[model samples]
Target: MRGRHCRSGRTGRKRRQKQQSHVDSVSLCHQPQYVRLMRFLHKQGFVSTLLQPALFSDTGRGLQTLKTIKPGQLLISLPESCLLTTATVLSSNLGHYIKSWRPRLSPLLALCVFLVCERHRGEASDWFPYISVLPTSYTCPAYFTDDVMAVLPASVRRRALDQREAVQEIHSSNLDFFRSLQLILSLPVEDVLTYEALRWAWCSVNTRSVFMSHPSNDFLSGQDVYALAPFLDLLNHRPDVQKSFCLQVKASFNNTTRCYDIRSVSGTPHFQQAFINYGSHDNQRLMLEYGFVAQGNPHSVVYVDTDLLCDALKRDRSLDQKIKFLRENDFLNNLTVSSEGPSWRLMTALRLLSLPQTLYHQWKAVLLGQAVSEEREEWSLQTARTLCQCLLQDTCKALDKIFFLLQHCDQLTREQLEVVQALRQEEKCILGSCLEALDGMWGQRDGLLSCQPDVGSVS
Candidate 1:
């Protein structure tokens, strides 16, 4: 959604001139339409949040405090009727058609189909007000053309390509599916299931939906996953900011209705941008899924795919059996390198990968948390450091090529430039940290082996 706030409605009030990054007076006050909407929500018990324009950045719109919101104050609460959950889709007229498939599709995919069909119905759709506010264009990497996605680093590129492939697959499947049902339903195929329209709906759900687990007893959908929280989804994610509230669905007096509630964990200052932490998501995730990136994200990480690690391990013949073992056990994928050296799983895998054939039988026992001698522990740490050093060297070369491309490229969109720049910075920083950690490990290698069992902190 565009900023949680919109630009409209002003009376005879004289407006104060302010910079584009500063909060304008007109936006600080609720607009007429928003006032009307607030009034309507108030009747439904959602009076705490106000849709106010953001102070900084272009097209700024977000929720602002109407009064001094104290800590533990209930920030917002909406009736369950407002949440667009799978239950809504299962109850829709399109539900029967979705159920006609031999093996049922995932709740998310089924919801996508329902959304497209409902959208085609225009004003007749029940959630038109919510749909009307959804942004037409999402800046997520999935929305980017292949050429633009190509400029991104391998870590982001892999994910973007995977998403692209998934979207295409879903689109093709849904197209074939709806076409088969067209005659039975007396509906035009193109009007309901076009790739462009489906893509829009998919992106909207991907970017805006919040995870609100449904009650276990509810039989509507197997997965207790994402739900659209209409106006609440407009708030921008601030990973660095302190969280103001948590969301929940609770039953009303007679348990006849469930209301969506935002219970404040801390007080929000008046006129300040209220933010929700979308979990400790890395920059790649935020950029790929949410269509925006937070500068200086502490959770930022660079991924080291297993294929690269396997290539490096191939040099050591002693690791052959161990590498095969790791792959067979499913521990060879999704390894990550962050500011704090290698991830625990990657480090453990490397430790096992470097173990001598004579001690290979101990791998399972060690993984089961059995105690190992100090010498063995030091050996494992040393082996892990060595493997990471090799990884760092290879990563540096890859980064160098990307750097050169970024320096020489003449034409790039603002979004592409921003993503590339952030990727380069994060990757370089992670590699630099790895190199520094390895150097420290090397310095302590002799001391650790000769004088004491203690190895200096590797992280």
Candidate 2:
């Protein structure tokens, strides 16, 4: 994403910049592990001569185009042999144990086990080239320390804790299967399959695996849909890519070639980093799954919890009934504020909560987009403004706490602090935007108490 060219600079400066770019590209391309990976991929019938690896100042590792690429050009075609799928695991020595185990392992757990075992095998493993380049440690929330976790917003922190527990439970529940590995492995099974080892393996598979459809396997516990594509995973996500451009390069399994292919929909100049769209994931999801957040992400959002909504709109005894209705209709979840202001779901919930007991019978109409009265409309707007203001204050306080932690806490690494700060900053921006939209709507009505709308009007 950082490969954009500077076209307006002076000719001498441009030439020097180009020279430095060439040097950086060459240095990354010649890295020993990448060199080994390329050779291995070539031997396995994988070829992508159009692209080479490069390190960016922002995004660490990404693929760079070797030449000017044209629209509809095949950027990468990874052969089946190079793909590490469940089929690969089933065929290996580990496959025999998987078949004989009592409780079938989930497709995810199987991949995690394979990665850890293979990594422990060192150079003797066939995937040594690919495995050698993986990050020694990851920054996913599971890897975050308690001090760093304390700085995360309440909702995000809860989800992060759930993720950590899920991984831990997976490891704890599979101890018997791990123990059985003692028969095949040289070292004690406990030494190689510890919780930390499994955590590393799980993060590797979770963050980098590509989706590849596999037929139903009775032996596997979950849906068979994950493949570790060796060189293809090097392509980092670019959240800013236009949807139309992303559509041009279709990625799918090529049945005829038995390879995974990706073609460019638009042309890219030589020496620029080639990126792939990883869907329109927000900064929160990106941080949760991939351990990184995008800057200026269009999909970023600020979540409003059910408790916060209730707290802002607490007015009468009917509050319980309104909350029950909202929950039953599945509107309580996914309540958020974004760059587009409060989501429709949030507005609908607010409208329902603002209804007076005398008009409670018409609650369904409110949800159906009918405005009962100008007073009710004003109430909803006031409640929304109150919620946004509360969240903005909370965000500012969180930022202050983060600054204090950064100054005094030695437990958190620089990368962890930066990630926490970025996530909070993004939430602050979204809340500010929501407040602005609410103010604009209030200004449009001139004076809330005086303005009146026709009863039963549809908004």
Candidate 3:
């Protein structure tokens, strides 16, 4: 859904550019398209290259600015004692630690510093300039020590230095290195380029939603986030919010339709289906456009515990870093677990598997309260069934909540609304199959009999 529609606009513009360049490469100031061209150049930091008129009249206008949030003026104060303590445990000589890092000053390290700074300041704007200028590839440690770091922006270097020093080091001996680190760390990186100019990643003021990290980079389907960016994660979860608004679905089973609601869960849903079409819910639209909608699905309170995923993640080097970071920083901690509610129990049970709701309902209904039935040897099947019902009910509520959020979504485009409609159809389809499967079971004399419900089309 977010594919062709999102790319067409860019493709069309590129085609139009060929014609525009042939017309008046000069007098760019006078061209209406010049403003947009200038904006693009500014956003990508290509103003100087494209602004040279005599050399090339193709793309002009240099003193352009993007819609990016401005760089933040940061001030993070820690207890002097804590700073002193950190200075001691993290490094013996701030100079040495900075020196140690000298062997490993990768771009990832630099971004980490900038991110920490932004988080400390509590502003997306704080990272705007850094994001625009950050390097994707890093040179060797030797270059970082002699050439790269030395030439970096003074501000960036200063911030980097401060972050290092905060970890604990012999402050007096490493003062000079710390200061140098700060200055060098801030310089605008060289030869940096990106296919997609992240022009800016600002917090959505109107939508009041934000995300921690973009999913397209090096991380897996759901990695790349730092705990400091919790606000960003909530914002990126627009899919979950959108799903809450769905009235029904085209269930995979039996192609049946049934009504669903989103209000079962009490949390405030930020938008509704109608808002997807108004072009106003930019945060939500961003997710849809990026094909990150699946990432934001309304997971009924059911899911696995951190320990399980962590153990699994440890064996894979690719997932290890993200898993460790999330654990160490407690990113998953922000995801609330409702201990005192039915929704919590239901979600917990359902998250265990990726099966349908009707089966879940029947299973949970049988095993939720009763003692282990002695008739059959193993209770695994019964236990599994009970959990399924809990999941089903919770899923229904999750969908209802999404719809509730959608009702308030007054700013999305018409096409986005169509996305919501598609999802609703899917929900109905699922529910219908569940009903059909349950009809035969309802007639069974013994509710807990082994005559399981027939399989449905939905998997």
Best by lDDT: 2
* 10 residues in a row with least lDDT, candidate 2: 450-459
lDDT of 1 at 370: 50
lDDT per residue (tens digit) for residues 1-459 in model 2: 233344434666867756644424343768899889989899999877888787866678887778888988898999999999999999998999998888899889988999999999999999899899988878899888887788787668899999899999999999999998988777999899999999999999999989898998778987888999988888888787653122224477898999999888678577777777788898888999999988778888888898787676554556777789889989898888886678787888878877666777887887787767777778777777777788888889888887887887554365777788899898888888888998788888745854323222312
Ranking by TM-score: 2, 1, 3
TM-score for candidate 1: 0.72
Cα RMSD (angstroms) for every candidate in the order listed: 9.7, 5.6, 22.2
Cα lDDT over the full model 1: 0.62
Whole-model Cα lDDT of every candidate shown, in order: 0.62, 0.81, 0.29
* Candidate 2 regions with alpha-carbon error over 4 angstroms: 1-27, 243-250, 408-412, 449-459
User: What C-alpha lDDT does candidate 3 achieve relative to the native structure?
Assistant: 0.29
Model 2 residue 58 CA deviation in Å: 1.9
Across 3-46, the per-residue lDDT of candidate 1 in tens digits comes to: 43333222211232123124442352345544554554555565
What's the CA error at residue 426 for candidate 3, in Å? 6.7
lDDT by residue for model 3 over 208-241, one digit each (tens)?
2112232332211223322221111111222333
